[model samples]
Target: VNPVDRWDGTPLADAVRAGHRQVVEMLSAAGAELKLDVSQTSVKLCDKAREGSVEGVRLLLDGSADVNAADYDGRTCLHLASATGNLMMTRELLKAKANVNSVDRWGGTPLADAVREGHSSVAKALLEHEARLEFDEVKTSSELCECARQGDINGLTMLLTAGADPNACDYDKRTCLHLAASVGNVAVVKRLLEHKAIVGAKDRWGGTPLADAVREGHEQVSELLLAAGATLDFSAERDARELCESARLGDIEGVKLLLAGKCAVNATDYDGRTCLHLAAATGNLVMAKELVAHGAGVSITDRWGGTPLSDAVHGGHFEVAMELRKHGAELKYSRLKTAGELCELARVGDTNLIRTMLAVGAEVDASDYDGRTCLMVACATGNMHVVQVLLDAKADPSVKDRWGATALADAVREGHAHVAKMLLAVGASIDLEPSEVVSRLCDYAGAGQLEHLELLLNCKADVDAADYDKRTALHVAASAGHLHIVEHLVSRGCRVDAVDRWGGTALSDAQREGFTHVCKFLEGRRQLVVLKRSSSQEQLNLK
Candidate 1:
């Protein structure tokens, strides 16, 4: 009698929610339709079923409700079933032609949901129903990830035997072996190795399984990896300093084994730092002596022309420094003549030893290849006592380094406000023209030294000085989201419209670096903010 009888509405949806099968059937016959578009309808059904209300789901299905109906976020009935791990309801929905691969707006499908949550039976059912095996072309079946994470050798073995790709990688190029090694699943790792999974396979950043094992301090896993013929000298990633890194960590046993396995004794890292350098830097007198005895080249100069002796002296390792000197390690070299030794001594506040070196005719004011004097090093290292000692020794404070940085510039660069004040008190000039003031200021701002920046500004440092790249301090501050610095620079009459060598404005740099706060600040100032198209814009837009 009612025209509304033909339309789906709340009463019939409520009947479905109540799980009253007879009432639901009567309502269906009376043409009381179930509302598919109601915001709470699908959610109620999902909630009922997830609460183990099997009758509710059956009644809804028999009434010809949308088997694949989605809630507000596009999570379908199967997604709810998988989430609740209701195997029977999930099987029934699959039999009714429910889309096994239907994903929420977040790209989470039934299989992904099941695997992520350890719904093993639901995951198996979905897989049997031909669910998509891979998610986003990189992350493999969440089932595999779960099994590896749980150390479930049996579950992992089953998945692999069921045609799961053992070699499938995650978004970070982390193969199953990487995950296994990370978790220290020795048995699972052995199985994977037996399956010929790439033992030396590198991840996105070039970390191998062995690297993972070592980093996590998994002793058994590390031993297994080493026994599997993983190259001891394998420098796959930032972990290239593997053996030396281990030694530096004081993994004496690990270091001994790695060295015994023929890792290069003098392998220099990206910084040209060797094992002996690290040992000396840490003041591990025993390790330093061991490395030297093992033929470590103590004389090998770092990128800064610093030897083991310099590292020891700089790190305050008097005993290690004495040991290195005993091994014929000279602090001063004719070539690459730098005050690295004196700077090292200053860094450790070793005034007595510094005087000893001076008494032995060590050049008190020698500059390095970069023309950085001991005074500049002292200022950069923020050691006030060392600065005073150097100043008293008649060290030149106004000398510029190869980078055109004076002692005052180094102090300001490192955000040592107290040290900068000390230098200023000693007649250090703050008005010298730095070759790349903008770049240096940008670096300092990026490091979050607002006080140091204030000091520079108060000294009336150039507000719009350009670096070699012609970028102003404003651009650097904007790019790095240093709002206070940007505000200060603007207050000091920095040109808001200045363009860098790349023709980018401060606003452009802010947007490029995704600095929303800086961008908003610049926009409020009515600055000409250019929106440049980045190569990764398409990807960002998709996200």
Candidate 2:
């Protein structure tokens, strides 16, 4: 007679549902207890609360029914009362000391459901009963986001007033401010901002409130965020390499977000291309102007020396070229295609591009803004066929870069000995003096480029060449603890006793820097060799 239905409702629940007082009393008297836990049901409490039956809930509470018992889905009596906007039953449950913050399976608290269901009075009552919007950050953030996304200002206010975090974020770190700004909810945004919500908080994907506002064309929201001291997010922008790609794809909206986030106006990729370069190549004149207005230099060059101006001209964007010239970009290169274009083609290792550009009357011997020639670019990248083609076209190999590095010097510096030999065959100059010695040997040794060091020495570069402080390759090698380069330099007859301006030899440098192996080798070798060279065999014999 007391069997439960498939919905977890017993005969007592049916009696209560139909308001049959005599049967409810008879069922209770016939051993029908209302208390049930997790897997079963908080059936009597939930049904009474859902029907706003204050007396039914009171009878159960007086019958020793557990006030905090929840159903299988974790929906407690308080959750049902609050969700149905039943203030009387909610207050009755609160009077019985109900768990106001009980979470349902969907992570909804009583206050959260009340707020989301537009039950302002019930939410207020729940808040007055000290109903926490969230005891869990994940659970609470979801409720806050629900209120914000629906533009329910009253519920949002109650949550915030009850000490809910203004910047509650979901799993993706998408904050309520991001949602509010994106939806153009000005009043909700104002309410959140009043609670001190971060105007430029970035999510997991680097999406910020202000960026969201701008991307969604919410001008007023954007202005509000900007007025709140929202600027670039350099930390997020560094890891986000999306700006260059956005510019290339003509995604101006995404560019606005990335540009606002990425502080560097001239930020470049691994290919050394900037947003301006991408915009010019794609003929996005509007994006180019935006970049220029934000202090992007039109004369900025890529790894192959391709500038925004030259890229614009090469792409036949005459309007973009004219616009670039107005921003102090000079058309300094000769002919139809710029020298930077030729240098870029040479760097690509495409022999056909070189021939085609050259056939179009492109200047071969001219230098780009970086003062690097096509032949130098070709030799630096070790593009054999491109180098041969340029050499055959009478491209001058003698031109030095801005760093005063000839094509041969560039080749040798990059360890391209084969290309260096080719440049030498064309009468390219080589100077293994102080500049070359310091740049090539010391740099290679300090960077632990033992192969480059061996190549330089094999090319007959001065073994003991030193810089201004008289710091040689051995000094840098020892200081940097490159034991292999130190041993190789010692084998090549570089003097260990040669002193710097500080009067410290390579041995002392190694010892001071705590290089045990280098110190041991130098200490053992020092005892075998004379400190100062003897001018004559008689002087050596006397020593």
Candidate 3:
């Protein structure tokens, strides 16, 4: 009478599925234990529970069916009832002594599902049953570093109070303390220090929290870190950047301070635009003359190949442009060029103009001094038609720019999967060095660049590749609170338990940072990894 069937369930479960209440009770009384696999269990039980079939559930429970017996996904009837907000079913399951804290495959507890689904009745009842909705599950401990980075003190406090580790470092080897200090969050620093976060912890680049504060010129944060015993090894770089801004704003006094501090008068900003360029562009004749007198080069070209005189002329500062000429700049070289026009057209997806240029014998592979071809420009902008035109005209997709970036790299970096596919079809190289692969993986994962991650995977990059800090792309995605990217990496079989140099796994990092969802996913994957290892050990032992 208790024999199992093809559906992997006993006669009582089959009778329950058939909805024969009399037969179900008859089978229950005849000693049938209600057991089932995924198909018969989660589906049938979920339907019965959601429909408030109290008698059916009671029949199974009274027939000695384990109330806590879960499906393959570890989902008990209680989880389903709580998720669907079926308070009636939840009460029935609870009355049968359901394990309220049972974690499903997705890391959902009955209370968590109840709370997430907004069934306060079920949630309160579960709480009364000794179910603790831990803050890690509720607030997503994966966001702790983000909270600290954003200066969300209340959120940080909640995460810390909920048991997130203060010293938990990210995939980049940076802790929440590092993020707070870098952003000049004095109150966050205080809270982190109170939690005993490592005062002198260094990042992957060996930059301490104090070093970050000092580099960003946050004097207050620097002072706080120093008081908490952090050391600094660099200064004056921020002032150099400030010099360019001061020159543009015509802050002559600030420029004087930078000059007095022996800052390089010719120091260029990130875009290779110097103080002379800014001063000239803003038509600040006094600032321009001061920079020129202090040895600013008028002939130096910026990233766009524009000289200071060119910037002044373009901005209608003819007077400043004339002054720059007097300051050892000779010719007003015309920035207008046919090749420049073609590249510009490609950038804006002007396919007809590009076609006309190509028809008129223009160099299809014409590049600027930076080695940026028209194809590279088109690919970076995801101009698929323009890229196709350039490709048909024999434009080299494999050409690398001055920064070693090819069309494929540019498309991937910008999340242009279609462009990357075209480049790949044309044999554009994905032959990156190990370091390049690691950099791309971490950068792409942290930025949530799914296209870039996919392109890297297509290139056969190692799913478990670690950076210098021993942190994988999975770790980076987890700490960034990017659950989608984290899931993608795990789907590709990344090691969830792969430990970083900070001795933190992806799950631990997510938990530390307040990404409870990421933690949940990683925790489930970790159990699978452990199970596989144990199975392998068993096989080896038998051998």
Off by over 4 Å in 3: 1-32, 43-142, 149-155, 161-163, 178-187, 199-223, 230-232, 235-543
Model 2 residue 149 lDDT score? 86
Cα lDDT tens digits, model 3, 317-419, are: 6667678777677433332354576678888887866764555345777677788888888988998999999999998887888878787877877778888
Model 2 alpha-carbon drift over 4 Å, by segment: 1-18, 26-40, 43-65, 138-152, 169-175, 178-185, 198-265, 269-271, 289-543
* RMSD to truth, every model: 22.8, 16.5, 34.2
Error in Å for residue 461 of model 3: 71
Clashes of each: 1, 0, 13
lDDT tens string, model 1, 6-91? 55455666676676778877878887766565455567656666777667777777666777777889887788888888898888
Instruction: Candidate 1: give the clashing pairs.
Output: 338-368
lDDT of each: 0.74, 0.78, 0.76
Provide the TM-score for each candidate, comma-separated. Answer: 0.59, 0.47, 0.38
TM-score of 3: 0.38
Ranking by lDDT: 2, 3, 1
For model 2, residues 1-543, the per-residue Cα lDDT tens digits are 557677766676666556676777777877885434433348767888888888878766654478888887888889998889888888888888998888888777998778767787888888887777664666567777887789989878877876788777789998889889888899999999999998878888777887667656577888888898886454424423456666777878767765665557687777787888888888899999988988888887787777887677677676777788788775345532466678888888867656645554467887877788888889889888888899989988778778777787777778887787787776766654567666678889999998788867766788898888898999999999999999999999998888999999999999999999999998877876753443455587888
Give the worst 10-residue stretch by lDDT in candidate 3: 133-142
Candidate 2: count the clashes: 0
Task: Report the lDDT of model 2 for residue 309.
Answer: 73
Name the better of 2 and 3 by lDDT.
Answer: 2
Give the distance in Å from residue 536's predicted Cα in candidate 3 to where it truly belongs: 99
